[model samples]
Target: MIANEIKKRVLIALLIILPILMAPVDLFLAPNYWVKSLVKCILFIGLPLILNNHYQWVSIKSMLTVTKKQLSLIALVMIATYGTIIFGYQLLERWFDFSMITVQLESSMAITKNNFWFVFFYIPLVNALVEEWFFRGFGFLTLKKFFSRRWSYFLSAIIFSLYHVAIMAHWFSPLLFTLLVIGLIGVGLFFNYINEKTGTFLTSYMVHAGANFAINTIGLYLFGMI
Candidate 1:
């Protein structure tokens, strides 16, 4: 009973508090971008691996592989997600001005724009892999121990969405931030859904990386920094 209570408390903090704390730490405490990203990766990915393993909160598995059918579906979804983002951005550009939007993120994205190859390569690969492993694989599964499967999924989504608060609130207008909250929460839920449905972490990672690729590639180019 004592052990179970400890596990529940730990998982609750991870799922509820860690994500909220991430923004402030990155925004105020971290000394530089390098440290900020490293800190985030360690907290989001490393801490879970260490604690969850120690607690035996989940079973270890080969989360990197997908069957042929799953692979095909992932490919189709990747293409569709990338295409949709591109199309949607084009439509937005036709009507609204994004100069204000781009400027808000200029400092945050300057490094990305300068390191085009890094953004093109790392963001979609290693970064996505770690995030999926942390959130869907560890965090969501841990919550399943204390909650129903659907509740686990939703809570994971909430944590993921809240994790971006510092960025969204600081780098976006109120209206844009509100919209982003809704969108990213939906995305978080969707990724968890895909992970559960396909029974592999790679599928959800692909969808996430694909979406980032779509947004970042065009945005960097437009900023004239890439």
Candidate 2:
């Protein structure tokens, strides 16, 4: 079962990694929006849920059946974190008027205009939810069962960081990439901590969704696209 889970993870990684690898080809050469969306949905999100050998830290029924207490706590943390993200982005933009991060996000602005529904809905909803489900849900939880808890967290953080590295590799400089990796690893650890603390993946998913929502929403505002 463990070996099968490992194999499943490897297969899932290829699903995700191939899209990241072919991003330029997809975006520049062919330019098929639906194809890219399908990859993100089926490969990244769908298969993870269907693959039986891997982790299911929070059962589907539990995810659906959140208690009143869980709902309140999730709302509280999400509100606080959402405020902090807007605050942090505002502060950071003041210092760095132009940034690699901004450049990366600007590229995504086309999606908001071209496919308003996908950007406004899918990005803040499905994309963010599945990422937490995949990285924190599957990666961190599965690793913890196999290794020391700290090692599990550390390996999970590394995997999370490395995944971003593939997506952002060609888009930034060495220095910028290093900083981005460091930042993502920190996010991975924090998300993992919240998952453990709340004893539910919903908190992490909510927070993750909030963060991505802020990024795209604020990016459009700053870029004068909205």
Which candidate should be chosen as best, given lDDT against the real structure?
Answer: 1
Best by TM-score: 1
How many collisions per candidate? 0, 0
Residues forming the 10-long window of minimal summed lDDT in candidate 2: 105-114
Instruction: Give all candidates' CA lDDT scores.
Output: 0.75, 0.64
Clashes of 2: 0
Candidate 1 wrong stretches, greater than 4 Å: 101-106, 109-112
Worst 10 residues of 1 by lDDT: 104-113
Candidate 2 local lDDT, 1-226, one digit each (tens): 8865666566456434644554554345433444555665665557657763354433555433456887788878877877887888778666454445445444632343445436756766877776676677656655555457897678778777776654566555676568779998998899888777665567788888878777766656755567
Steric clash pairs (candidate 1): none
What digit string (tens of lDDT, one per residue) describes model 1 on residues 1-226? 9998898888888866666767776566763456666877888787877887888887657555679998898999999999999998888776655666455554554444555656567777777777777778777755776778888888888778777777556665577678789888899888988887877678888998898888877777676765
